[model samples]
Target chain A: MIQRRHALTVRVTHWINAVALILLLMSGLQIFNAHPSLYWGPSSYTGAGPIFELAGGFPSWLTIPGTQWLAMGRRWHFFFAWILVINGLAYLIFSIATHHVTRDLAPTRSDWRSIGRSIADHLRLRHPQGEAATRYNVLQKLSYIAVIFVLLPLMVLTGWSMSPRLDSVWPGWVDIFGGRQSARTLHFVIAWLLVLFFFIHVFEVIVTGFWNNLRSMITGRYRIEHEQR
Target chain B: MASGGVLLSACDAASRNPHVTKVLSIGEFLSQHVQHAVTSRTALAQEFTEADLSPEFRSNGTDYPDSAEYRALAMNGFVDWRLRVDGLVERPVELSLDQLRAMRSRTQITRHDCVEGWSAIGKWTGTPLSEVLALVHPLADARYVMFYSADPMDDWGTRYYESIDMEDAYHPQTILAYALNDATLPIPNGAPLRLRLERQLGYKMAKYLMHIELVDSFARIHGGKGGYWEDEGYEWYAGI
Candidate 1:
């Protein structure tokens, strides 16, 4: 059976987000390489030193320049940051106006009841087939919701928190995360969490049906092999 | 910088291309405009209490001046040094360290944020840049206040320089800091005098006092950017 799984808006934004995220992560690590350390609270050189330290930072292959250039790193990061923000904003507004959030993403009462079975199914490497395959599972819906609503917005806010210019918008907004350095720490953590989500997302795609899922994201078309009765 | 690339070695040169840099500048331009539009000009950077002070502020970039003129002034405790205030100003006055120290001072414990993503909080006490501007009487043509430093950033003796627009130059927290942590400024931390631009990153705060020039534009200056780092590829507005 064939079905339309993703909207055109969704397909377009998915690719943009993928490209923007990859560039943002690479360039972000490049910037982090300059300092090679993370700290908590307000300041870094408090004599107590960094809470977590990486002597040489992440390897160059993982960085955008494939080398250490703080200035270039910043250039790549700030450039793509705008792209991601704009794309994400468009996706959010489109989703709200179309009620895509309620229709496709929000979990229903039945979905909540299926939570335990979904976990068992996932552990067994079993995926819903036929008509169910056309719709998101409860787990899928929850994960996407968390990433879109909770994590992504927090990442952007934490980023703004670290900016001295943005801090002028409200004198001590960064204190919500403890301080500027604390905000930095949270931003790093959220980046890794997003990375983790990427790996899991790809893994699920491969295990379930890579070609079908990939094509859906690319062309908004999903083909389902109907299960025999 | 010597480490080997584990992946994407093919694209290394792509990042260094000028065309790529030109493309990337769109965000920088947008960021500056967005920040100025969103935030009030008089808004202050967050300040901290004495308890939040860092034990020791790490000094990056140039620690000491290698120039003979800077060393001579340093050797004599900067008594002979005079801060020249000129350019787009009517008075064009010069003030000594003692004179600056005597000005009505403003003290605040503020964080120094570096472009490299490190921060240090310390108490800064100094003559506000506004006080100097008031004495000199900036002309209507003045748009930016350019700061010249003692340290030579290159082999050609192009002294480190930085500039701020009128809004930042007149900010209450923008001061020509002469002291840190209630003591005389140390050699490593821009001795005699330095700038404290609390709303921006560390590089904007030029150190090792020499001259303050109020100008209509910095386009004719070195590399046609506002500061040393700006000439070397860093963003001119580093409030980020």
Candidate 2:
């Protein structure tokens, strides 16, 4: 019996990050009073554009109906942003110091094949390949890599696009996103994508064997059937 | 539903996309409810210490409205122009710039987050909107207030108007502003008169304001959507 791995710091960080992302998303939606329209295809909402008024001090009565809640939403968002940033930095520092990031998150050659097989198996498109699965399956590695590298960085960059100072400090970032308005739109769309990713991830876990997958994340060890090998 | 009542057909278009529209409507409703509960007809938009204030607060939309009449008012120190308050009020009144200046005022330092994804912080000073509304004596049926501007915005030619429910109207921080950063309102900043509905997105604070009308509802307004952007599918209530 390969003993189950004990709870590790990365697991804690991952769960914390997941929770923080949820809060960030909910608060962000509340603040997204600028353009509330959603389109199905190529047609878009014009209110998606930008309107620059440096320091807002308008009578609430002058506003349309939904903006008042956004006021409180913005306050929570600012405070929560600081928490997320600090938490992320701390996770990064700890991961680097412990070499956990390189050892665990880095993909091996065999991982690509196994991950692909796992995806096929999960979709019921292929039979499970016989192999002695180690700590994490192939799908887990890919998801982890994408979340850490692609989604996390995109979120941070897009979030910063809203800063007026960003244009002065990192003109390149604003330019990369086309313009501030485009960046804002991208930020919101990406946020929605992440939310979609989160739901799918949770659903997959439940479908695959909720207790088995969940326990591994919590206790750091999952059982594999001897016959599968 | 009545013929002369606020026309609500545009709202029928808005209702077609209900999920988005519902969220937008809820925001507007909440602002009104909160504004009504607050004392002094104003609520402080969030406040900030000196450290939070940005070095520059970029102006948006029209820094200075291009209308010739408004330019004349600006050139002459805005002494002649008056802010009119009528519509659903029992006592219609007009206030000169000086009289508005003499009223009690508040100064706040807050952040302005633009829809275009940029933000800045600045200090603003203005008379509470509650004080001005009080002068007109809003009737009991007046559930919403409308703001009309002299500036023509985009294709929404001639008038720039916005309406909010009474609750937000009474927020303590809600103001009919005449100053920015301790100076008289700049021409580009809706000088001589502008509204600062703190707690909303930037566009809600329409500048170069001309009239305030009290109404039972917003359905009869142009496009029947409460604001220029609202007419064009932007969320009617841009709170935060």
* Reference-based TM-score, model 1: 0.97
**lDDT score at residue B68, model 1, on the 0-100 scale:** 97
Q: Calculate the i-RMS of every candidate, to one decimal place.
A: 2.0, 14.4
Taking the tens digit of each residue's C-alpha lDDT, what string does model 2 give over B1-240? 253122222322333555645554554455434434442333244465566455555778877776788889888888889999999888998899888878898887655656533555567888888998888888899998889998877664657888877877887767888877777878777877787776666777888888999998888788898987677666565542
| TM-score of candidate 2 chain A against the true chain A | 0.74
Best by DockQ: 1
- Per-prediction DockQ scores? 0.70, 0.04
**Model 2 stretches with alpha carbons more than 4 Å out:** A1-229, B1-43, B154-156
lDDT of 2 by residue, A1-229 (tens): 4346434776686677776676567557655544453322111222232333323433332222224454444434544565666677888888789876677667678877577567777688343322334445666667767877787787777666554323324323455765444566677777877877788788877776678668777888776555632
**Candidate 1: regions farther than 4 A off:** B1-11
Candidate 2's displacement at residue A29, Å, is 14
**CAPRI quality band, candidate 1:** medium
Q: How many backbone clashes does candidate 1 have?
A: 0
Model 1: per-residue Cα lDDT over A52-169, one tens digit each: 8899999877898877888888888999999999999999999999999999999999999999999999999999998999888999999999999999999899988888989989
Go through the candidates in order and give the clash count of each.
Answer: 0, 36
